[model samples]
Target: MKKVGSFVGDWWRLVSPYFRSEEWPYAIPLLIGAIALTLGSVGLEVLFNDWSRRFYDALEKKDEAAFWREIMTFSWLAALFIAAAVTRYIVSPYLRLRWRRWLTGRYLAHWLDSRGYYRIELERTIDNADQRIAEDLRQLGEYTMQLLLGFISAVATLISFLFILWQLSGPLSLKFIGIDVEIPGYMAIAALLYAIVGTFLANVVGRRLISLNFMKQRYEANFRFGLVRVRENSEGIALYGGEQREMDMLNLRFADVFRNGWRVLFTEAQLTLYQAGYAQMAIIFPYLVTAPRFFAGAITLGVMMQTASAFGQVYTALSFFVNNYTAVAELRAVMDRLQGLQEASDKKPATAIAVEPQPGGRDIAVEAMTLALPHGQTLLADTTLVLSRGTSTLISGTSGSGKSTLFRALAGIWPFGSGRVHVPAGARVLFLPQKPYIPIGTLRDAVKYPDEHSAASDGEIVAALETARLGHLAGRLDEDTHWTNILSGGEQQRLAIARALVFKPDWLFLDEATASLDEVNEAAVYDALKRQLPGTTLVSIGHRPSLRQWHDRRLELQRTPGEAGRLVEGAAPA
Candidate 1:
């Protein structure tokens, strides 16, 4: 009971928000209409059950006129049933689609907001959040509607038919141990007990399905992620001749999927076996119990057929759980995954670092700032530095000496740290990494990316490209393609430089942003930046000695063994 309550609570937490949201005006009416159609469908079934009794009686009596009358009666009932079913079919899926759209938007916002996606990656607690948002939410919306409406219809049918079955039940008299025992509503009692036993057994047989389905989704997502990695790094893998290694790794991932799939199939088979037998028995069990009265002339043929129909409806309603155990299990697994994502997104991490904006300030300050890796190993310890306005500075360090980590700390994204970073309010700062992200779109859009609505004119963009040594790409500014694949490493870096040139940030931090370019091209890019944006503060991380001429100040990260790196003001390395 507690588990059930908890499940309901979790489900409500996920579902109720949509109905209460701004979309509720549309959502509530669709939901009520779908539910109304469900109840109407159930009402139609009751009318059909009554029709069955009259039709059978007319057939038994060989009354042609009465038979035609019931036939006419059935025509309207069938027409109404079909109309309701069709309307529900259209309305229900449309509602589910809208619900799914709203949920997708909400989850996307949560995942992308406040760099929640980055934090989740840093924590490594959630796996394949893409799948959770895409596949799980889709299944959640469909399954929730499917199961909710089915359950409601089942309950309504149960109530409506249980009374009819009770009235038709009469009494069952039996002699047991020399005592007369009379059972009232015997058929109803029999159906309730049968469904209870079936449901219990189904639960026992399919109890493993929920966890298995959960693992199944995980394994599938892992396998897909592996495939995507191979596609994204196909060039590197081919250069290394690592196709066999990749194939082996992918096979292992798929093997997890395959093994879990077999377990699910076997579990489902067990449940299906029991359910099939139970369903077939239910087809004849009604006649078997109610036939004795018909043979004894205690009831007419109409009553016997009606009793059988009502018994079927009542038993089906009571067996709802038994029939949908697999779907229920799947829904539970999806809910668990989505709930995990929701909670993770909502959770605010308690980090020691505080990033604040200083209004009307001219410099960026790092006060007693310390940076650590995820495993608690110190990267930079108790380092205080100030990046003054209108200065060009270069940061250099040995490989793995936390230069980039310090950059992340300044950018207010490195959560595994302590201390404070104060940036000037409304300051436009840009950090360009080594391999710039070339969004799969036009070259103009790529240059103006991270700012889709930049006010840069086409002429400015083309001039920036020419200045960054990408003059050849000026003609293809409007050509839409995967820019990452099309451009070489050096060209991609130049494109990023062009983007930086266009944006003209007050503070520009380049983390090895020109590592791929030749010395002449790199020099040209820097010279262009100095000439065009003379007031911009340039902070760079690079080991190349040629980079020294571009900056007036140099800071190196110095570290002793087993200690965190510290920023030391020094001359550029010869």
Candidate 2:
């Protein structure tokens, strides 16, 4: 009961936003139209129930004229019912689509903001976020439409049919211990009790399904993700001949899926047996109970049939939750997953990188900066460093000396740290890591990205490509393809340098950006950069001996005895 209460509360919290969002103009009208159509459909059912009694009575009387009149009545009722049903069918999906659109946009924005995607990965706060956003959101939208319409229909039918059953059932007289007693609406009362009992048993049989469904979703997504990873890295695996190892890992993941599938099948099979029996019995239970009165001549044949029809409608309406238990469980799992993603995205970092703007400043300064890994191991303590604007500085350190980590801190992305990083106000800064991100798009779009394709003129783009010795790609700017897979390592790196030239930021930080190129080609690229972006502040992390001559100053991360590394000044060898 407690778990059910929490699920209801969380579902409402997750769902109420769309109705209140900026898209309410469409959402509100579609919702109102769908609901109105549902109520009208219920009214048509009530009319049909009346028509059934009249048609049967006409048959009993052997009257052809009255029979034809009732047939006409039914034809009109069926036509109206079809109209109501079809209109609702069209409008309900529109409502669902619009709601999903609003919700998908919001979730994507929140997940991408504040580096939430990156932070969630570093901390492992949530698993399968991508799947939750893409797949589970779609499920939520679909289930929400079906469940909402079903609930409304159930409630309305229960109300409309309860009165019909009561009027048709009349009264039943019973003897108990030599005393006589009469019960009104006996068939209606019987259906109420039957539905209640069935619901209780179904809940008892199916209550464990919610948590199982949650884990099953996670495990399935993990298994699928593993296969996708293999597909993306198939080249590397083939080169290393690690097919057997990959197969073993994949099999291990699939075992979880197989094991859980059996459990789900077992539970569903049990529930299905009970549900099938319950539904079949409902078809005849109404007749069995009310036939005694009919045989005794207390009611006519038409009354008996009307009574059975009304009883069926009432019972089915009351059994709504019992019939939809599995769907409810699945919806609960999706809602909980989405709730976890939202909570993880909203979490505040324990440590933050403080970026301060210095007015009229010419240098980037780090004061009392402390660097720590995500696991809380300190890398650098109380490190202070400065890089003047329009000057070339190279950062050299031993392996694993927090060189790339420092660059992340300066970029205001590494959050497991405390420090003040002051940059010149209004200065544009860009960071280029060794493996730069190459989005799947046209060559022109990839070069300008993080920028629109039209951000740079054609002449400027051509000039930057020529300077980086990537003139071969200039003509292919408008051609759409996955340039990442098509370009070689050297070409990709050169394309990244060309991006820097096109963007022309005031400060550029390179973390082994040119490591893939030959020494001569690397030198030529640097010389071209110097000629093109003379006013840009260049800070680089490199290990090659040939890189020292381009930079005027150098800094190194030196180890201290029994303590973290410290940043200090250093000089290049003559």
Candidate 3:
């Protein structure tokens, strides 16, 4: 009971936000529509059950006219039932889809907000977040709809059928040693008891299924992610002839999936045995219990048939938990995963650095900054520096000298640090990594990315592309494709530069952004930046000697044994 309460609490915490959001306008109405339709369907079922007794009575009485009349009544009831079912079928899925859309949108917003996606990556506490957002959210929506509606329908049906069974079965009298004990609504009581036992045993047998299912989802997601990784890196793998190694690793991931899948299968098989047996016996159990009264001529054949049908309905309704154990288990699993992700996303990194804005200042300043690795190892020593306006500064550091990490700190994305990074208020800045991130869209959109494509005029976009020496791509601006896969590394870098030009920010920080290009193209790109964006303050991290001449000053990261890297400002060595 405690476990169940915890599960429900977690589920509500995750799901209640949507109904309270702007989506409530449509979500509430659709939910009410579905519920109303479900209730209508249940009403139709009650009418059909009553009709069944009449139809059977008409047949036994051998009254042709009465039988024909009941048939006509059944025709009307069946039609209404069909209409209710059809309407419910349409309304329910529509509700599910609407709810799913709202839920997916909400989750996407939270996951992407405030660099939560990047922080989640740095934290490394949540695995398969892509799956959590995409697959788990989908499952959460689908299963929530199914289980909620099924429960509502079951409760309504249980009440309706319990009354019918009470009326149809009447009382059963048992002779005690010296007195008679009368049990009222015996069929309802019997069905309730049967369902209770079935539910208890089902839980006992299927308790482990929850953790197994959790593992199964993780394993499946891991395997799928592996395949996607291989597909994305197919070029690298092919170039290195690492097909055999990748195949071996893929097989290893699949082994976990295969092992966990069989465990799920076996558990499901056990559950199915109990559920199937419970269901089959339910068919004859009602007849078995009531046969004595039927044989004694105490009730008519119609009454006997009615009693059995009512018992079945009542039992099925009460057995809702038993029948839906697997779905409930999966539902709990998805809820736990989404809840974990939500909690993890809410956490601010323990090593978060503070960035303050200096009003009316025209420079980016790092004051007494100390950056630490996750394990508390120092990456950068106390550093104080400023890059003023109209001066292009180059940062040169050996590998792992924390140049890129410093760029991240300045950009306000890197969290593991201390001290203040002061940026001029309302200043626009762009950070270009070594490998540019090309969103999956048109080349035009990718070039204008991080900003809407409409943010730039066609002429501006073409000019930026031409400045970055990518005039060949100007004609294909409207073409939609995966720019990452189609564009070569050098081309990607050039496009990133073009992207920077289109934005025309007040400051630009390049973290080995031009390293992928040859020296000629690299030098030409730097020259183009100076010519086109002369007013833009440029801070670049590079190793090429050719890059030193373009900048007025350079910051070099110098380190000795047992000490973190320190920034030293001087002229670049030509």
Could you tell me every candidate's TM-score relative to the true structure? 0.98, 0.96, 0.96
Question: Which candidate should be chosen as best, given TM-score against the real structure?
Answer: 1
Model 3: residue 112 alpha-carbon error in angstroms: 0.8
lDDT of 3 by residue, 1-574 (tens): 8988998888898778878888888888888988898888888888878878888888888989999998899888888888878888888788778777877887777788878778888878788888988888888878988888889999999999999998888787887455588899998999999999999999998888899999998999999999999999989999999999999999999999999999999999999999999999999998997899889988877888888998998999999999999999999889888887887777787666678889999888888888876667787867788888888898887877777888888888887878788889998889999989999988888988898844688889999999889999889988998878998999999999999888888999999999999999998899988888877888899878888888888988876645688888867556
> Candidate 3, clashing residue pairs?
none
Stretches of candidate 3 off by over 4 Å are 176-180, 453-455, 560-563, 572-574
Report the C-alpha lDDT of model 1 over 1-574, residue by residue, as the tens digit: 8988998898899999999999999999999999999999999999999999999999889999999999999999999999998999999999999999999999999988877788788888799999999999999988899899999999999999999999998988887456599899999999999999989999999989999999999999999999999998888899999999999999999999999999999999999999999999999999999998999999889999999999999999999999999998999999999988887776666666778999999999989888898778898878788999987889998888888888787888787879998889998899998878989988899999888879999999999999998899899988999888778899999999999988989999999999999899989999999999987899999989899999989998987656777788987445
lDDT of 3 at 519: 91
Query: Which ten-residue region of model 1 has the weakest summed lDDT?
Result: 343-352
Q: What is the C-alpha lDDT of each candidate?
A: 0.91, 0.87, 0.87
For candidate 2, report its TM-score.
0.96
Off by over 4 Å in 2: 176-179, 559-563
Tell me how candidate 2 scores on lDDT.
0.87
After superposing all C-alphas onto the true structure, candidate 3 shows an RMSD in angstroms of 1.9
Candidate 2 per-residue C-alpha lDDT over 1-574 given as tens digits, one digit per residue, 9 for 90 to 100: 8976897788889888898888988988999998889888888888888888888888988889999999999889989988887898899988888887888899988898988888899899999999999888888988887788788988999999998899889887787456598899988899899999999999988877888888899989999999999987887899999999999999999999888878888888888899999999999998888888788988777787788889888988999988998998889889989999999888878778798999999899998899988888888888788888867999888878788988889998888989899999999888999888999888887888776744698888888888889898889888898787688788889999999998888999999899999999899989988888898989999878788888988888876534588877877555
Q: What is the C-alpha RMSD of each candidate to the true structure, in Å?
A: 1.4, 1.8, 1.9
After TM-score superposition, what is the CA distance of residue 119 in candidate 1 from its true location, in Å?
A: 1.5
